[model samples]
Target: MSNINLKTPVDPKDAYVLVVEDNVSNFVLIARLLAFMGVQKCEWKTTGWGVVDFANTMSRVDLILMDLRLPHEDGYEALKQIRTDPHLQNTLVVVVTAHGSSAEMHKAREAGFDGFLSKPLDADRFPEQIKQILNGEPVWDLGI
Candidate 1:
């Protein structure tokens, strides 16, 4: 993992971020990135069903970085269910996927994603991107 500095660091230890991804390598990379950002309360779920189940047990979550494709249910359904749930509604959920075309972004937006970040994330800018999203700025970095 690479050490990327945050220009305006937000104590990541104070936040709870849930990562929903099926790919182990992707999860590892994201987990490492979150760790490097100083995030201590990070959780992982391998499937969409797992995330929903995990969220039911979690009292608070600051953000959710979810993959569009998964083993069982897709990210879209998971996100929709999460958003509708009174317990998890206000939590920030962003789609982190390889499909970053204009149409895909539009679809994600329509699906009520707080943000959308392209896959093979830019390690150099990831910290800032996450910070921006946490700060109420919608990140749409297509990695273009």
Candidate 2:
């Protein structure tokens, strides 16, 4: 994991964020924003199939930004697996996707996402939102 020194509203330097996104551009954008938010350790995975293995390798993870639509396994299925895993059951898993319809959000909630942040996240407020979620607050900003 690489370290960054960007100023943010909150100190998320200790936070470890894993972004499960198949799209390279989207992942880059999210990683850049997280770095800008002072998040020191940010990892990426292109498919949902690797999520469990990745989680198994990590001792602890602060958050997971899961894209609802993935190549092999969908985000919902991945979330179910993650929730069932003893090691990662309590980890924060937020749905980060472009599908921000109310119905989609509801389904994501029912599928057990800790929070929901729509795509094209507001750069100015992303850090604050993440900070709140890290502090045990449920954030549901669909941005619709």
In candidate 1, how many Å is residue 22 off? Answer: 0.3
What digit string (tens of lDDT, one per residue) describes model 1 on residues 1-144?
111222243457677889999999999999898889888888899889757669878767788999998888889989878877877877788889988888998888888888889999988999888878766677887999
Q: How do all models score by TM-score?
A: 0.90, 0.89
Judged by whole-model lDDT over C-alpha atoms, candidate 2 comes out at 0.82
Count clashes in each candidate, considering only residues at least 3 apart in sequence or on different chains.
Answer: 0, 0
Clashes of 2: 0
* Residue range 26-74, candidate 2, lDDT tens digits: 9998898889878988889898997989977876677899998999998
Worst 10 residues of 1 by lDDT: 1-10
Residue ranges of candidate 2 with Cα displaced over 4 Å: 1-11
